[model samples]
Target: MRLRPHHLLCTQGYSGKGYSEAFVKNMDAVVHRLRTEDKTPIELVFSTDDLCSCCPDMLDTDLCRENEKVKLFDRKTAEYFGLEEKTYIYQKLASYIRRHITPDMLADICHGCSWYPASACREKITGIK
Candidate 1:
């Protein structure tokens, strides 16, 4: 969905709010658990630190008010998994939406997409069974 329009259409993006210390810890634990459970190096990103409301987890039609877990994970845990670090901000993403960058952030965003070995490729390998 994001890729289709992102590559040829729009890709403006932005950040939401700050993260809580507890949520950060929980996210770390969750990432560990998810990878272990999936038997792959997959990380379910939390786009917000403030999970005080279901807003962060739910896809409400309204604008999301959550922190970017992907950005945080890239900074906090990618190296541990032997992955490269990447960052993105709404300001730039917003511009990307407007076709600011040549390739745009859309392609870069998938660079860290954690669903490969976890969900998409789960059946191909015996790791996640």
Candidate 2:
């Protein structure tokens, strides 16, 4: 899975009503698969990949309607983690997430997201009430 930087955060299990059912299903499957497999191949890239490929809002084949919004998520994650484009193990990435990302940071990054208010991801990552 070649994922954009922002997807590193979004794939932690957030779902919004605006997404297509197919997008939701594919994302769920991808996240589950990555979590269960110890060495699933994941590369950090600037362009879209597995997750955005299924998005209903995709335009011109690969661009997302929410591309700017997604970019913010990516930027914040990269800034906090000192990320670079590289191949990584999914399990290792998950560990980095648990170790490096903080609740306040996730909250600020996701605040502008349309799904922010109802996101299970927000609750899980931040325990925010």
Candidate 3:
């Protein structure tokens, strides 16, 4: 079924209430509680800007970059895995390369986990030039 528009809480009676944080918090707690309830299983899926959550550092995105298993975890969380070789982020980077972001030298663009900072594509995002 389509999942995008489902409200975390039903707001049918209330129009004056603007963005219910209380309802959101209660809903979040309910979701966490129900997940381990054993009688019912609730599966929530979202993208990894994901692997970022598991990691303490967003500047160093290595946990997602280095281990394919963590990558697979995010995949499994989002959906059933194995639909592609490259990730959505990787593909977006590749697309950037094809367009405006020309690398000045070979070393500037890294192919694999190079053990630098968590900043995966630092130069691209920072506007260093």
- Mind giving the per-residue lDDT tens digits that candidate 2 earns over 39-123? 8878998667888888877774446787787777777777877888899776787677766667788887776886766667765
Each prediction's Cα lDDT score?
0.30, 0.74, 0.30
lDDT of 1 by residue, 1-129 (tens): 011111111111211112455544644443334334423221223232223222234344322332254444333333222232223332333233334333223234334444432332222221223
- Which of candidates 1 and 2 is the stronger one according to TM-score? 2
What CA root-mean-square deviation does each model show from the true structure? 16.0, 2.1, 18.6
Candidate 1 matches the true fold with a TM-score of 0.24
Candidate 2 similarity to native, TM-score: 0.85
Give me the candidate number with maximum lDDT: 2
The C-alpha TM-scores of every prediction are 0.24, 0.85, 0.19
Pairs of colliding residues, candidate 3: 59-118, 59-119, 60-118, 61-118
Deviation in Å, model 1, residue 112 alpha carbon? 14
How many clashing pairs in candidate 2?
0
Candidate 3 backbone clash number: 4
Candidate 3 C-alpha lDDT tens digits along 2-69: 01001111111112222245544543444444333444322222332321332333234334333454
Which residue pairs in model 2 clash with each other? none
Candidate 1: stretches off by over 4 Å? 1-18, 39-62, 66-107, 110-129
Q: How far is candidate 2 from the true structure (C-alpha RMSD, Å)?
A: 2.1
Q: What TM-score does structure 3 among the candidates reach?
A: 0.19
